[model samples]
Target: MLFFVALLVDGILAGSVYALVALAFVVVYRVSRVINFSLGEWVTFAARLVGTGTHALALPLAGALAFASAGMAALALAFNHVVLHRLIGHPPISLVMVTIGFGAVLQASTVLFFPAGSGAISLPVPSEPIEIGGLFLVPGKLVAAAIAGLGVLIVARVYRTRTGLALRAIADDPQAAMASGIDIDRHVVLTWSMAGVIAVVAGTLSAAVWGGGLSLVLVGLKVFPIVVVGGMDSVAGTVVGALLIGVLESEAAGYLNPVLGAGFSSLAPYLVLLGVLLVRPYGLFGTPGIERI
Candidate 1:
């Protein structure tokens, strides 16, 4: 029972990171109306920047992460202004395809620039275990959760900004917002870059636990079920989904893995995704406006 509780706690903390990324997805999709499939590449690019900054260029870790996020945000702005700007009214497929191409560009650049990528690395923080009663906690996971929580708060604050209000209007109807004198290009470019910050945090957390490598890009796949399970358009729903998925995944890996074997642990989230979609196609908190993942 105690072990089960520990697994639950760990999963919830880990899910906080996924929730952060999911919030990014919600933010981007709500305004842009295009699901950027190249999300993984974005994450890898940010992680590579951090890895290169710290290990290769001898910069401090926090500074490296901050610089990486800032650089990525700039890159996102460039992407929106330079590429997506022209395709503003293009079909969704065209926009998605462009994003895919852009992702490929990002991945290729990471390989070319880094050559030898950052290998497995943990954060430069104390790894001491903290015990509360009989429960023990990992400092790394605690820090990750705190960062995720802070990110959620930041996202909430964004929704109440004047810019956010304009963005919301644009999200409701781009054509109408444009007719009403909203600067669609300016707002989108600004908002799109925010995703870069989220991606950096997600990428960095993954690096601290899993390693900073090209494979870190694939971890983006892990976030899919999260946004899907929670409504992709709902920030609050994403948090609930992340926690639900996180705890279930932890339980499956902790207990079921021993009996059902290794692969099942990794498959648990997708399995839940399938189950949820079968029942709620729009997701737990999603509206019926958009249908399709």
Candidate 2:
């Protein structure tokens, strides 16, 4: 029982990270209706920036983080104004393929810039573990979880504001929003910028926990199951899904891994995604689509 409790706690904390990343996906989708497959590349790019700022440039922790945030935000805005902006009114398939190509470009760029043999980027957090009632937790993980929770709160609060309402209107119907004088381009750019910030924060915190590496891009892929299970359009659902997936993954790692061999935890989220799709095709909070032939 105690062991299970520990697993649960760990999973919740880890899930918080996924929740943050998933929120980025939800935010972009809500506004632009684009899947933004290159999101992982953005995250990888931010992580690399953080690593370079700290390790190579020798910037202070706070400065490195700020630099990463600004850099990512700028990159996102540029991608929107330069690439995506030109492709407006094109087929959704074209945009998706462009994002995929962008991700490949980012991956190749990272390899070119950082080259092979780049070591782990060290975070400023202490190496000590925190003990709470006989349970030990990594300080970095705890801090990251706290940050992720705060991010969720901030985003939730934003949804109540006028700007959020405008974004929501655009999401509901772009044509209607444009008719109402809501600048679709402006809102899309703003949404992309926000997505950039979220990706940076999540990527940096994840790097703090696991260290910066090329593989950090995979974090974006992990968020897919999270948002899908929670309902792509529902922020509340995203939070719940993240927590559920996190705990289940933790449990699988702690108890099932030894018996089932390693890697079960990694596969747990997808299994849940399949189950959710089969049972609730629209997701827990997603509105069911109706079509008449």
Candidate 3:
């Protein structure tokens, strides 16, 4: 029982990071209706920026994080202005494909610019392990989880503010919002910028957990299941979905991996995702849309 509890705790800690990444996806989708397939690339880019800033530039950890955040926000704005801006009226499929292509470009750029042999980026947090009544926890993971929780709270609070109301209005009816004198383009840019910043924070926390590198980009792909399971348009659902997936993955890895011969934890999320799709296509908290032909 103690072991089970330990695993559950660990899963929740890990889920906090996943929740942040899924929240980033939700933010962009809510505003622009774009899935932002290139989100993983942005995360990878931010992680690389931090790695570069810390190692090559020899800056303090705080300084490196600040630099990465600013750089990512600028890049997001530039991408929005230069590429996304031109494709505003395009179909959703077109937007998704463009983002996929952008992700490919980012992957190539990361390979070309970052050092081929660069190892893990060190964070400033303590490396000690905390043990309590036979349950052990890593300080870094605890800190990351706390930060992620705090971030979610801040985002939730944002939804109550005037700017968030404007954002919600744009999401509900872009045409009506524009008619009301809301600057859709400007708001879209701001949403993307906010997503970029969130991506940086998520990537940094994830890198601290799994070590920094291009591999961290895969975390972006992992977030899809969380978003899908939670409800694409529901921020609160993201938190619940993250925790559910995290716990299931942890339990599966602990109990089933030996029989399944490993890698079960990674596969568990997609399995849940499939089940959610089959049972509730719109997701647990997603509202089904009604269309008249």
Q: After superposition, how far is residue 275 of candidate 1 from its true place, in Å?
A: 2.7
lDDT tens readout by residue for model 3, 1-293: 99899989999999998899888888888888888888788788888888788888888778888888899889888887898778888887888998899999988998899885342565567898989889889989999999999999888888779888889999889889999999988888888888888988888888889877778777788777888888988899899999998898889989999899698888989988899889887788876777999
Best by lDDT: 3
Clashes within 3 Å, all models in order? 0, 0, 0
Best-matching candidate per TM-score: 3
- TM per prediction: 0.90, 0.94, 0.95
For candidate 1, give the lDDT of residue 179: 99
Q: What is the lDDT of residue 290 in candidate 2?
A: 80
Looking at model 1, the pairs that clash are none
Error of 1 at 143 (Å): 0.6
How do the candidates rank by lDDT, highest first?
Answer: 3, 2, 1
- lDDT at residue 129 of model 3 (Cα atoms): 90
Candidate 3 residue pairs in clash (backbone atoms < 3 Å) = none
Error of 1 at 138 (Å): 1.5
Q: Estimate, for each residue in 36-147, the C-alpha lDDT of model 1 and write its tens digit.
A: 8788888888888888788887888888888888998998888887888799668889998998898899889888887565744467678888998799888888887898
User: Model 1, 242: alpha-carbon shift in Å?
Assistant: 1.6
Give one digit per residue, the lDDT tens place, for model 2 in 44-130: 777787777777888876787788788888988898888888888899999899889998998888788973533255555787998
Report the C-alpha displacement of residue 216, candidate 3, in angstroms: 1.2
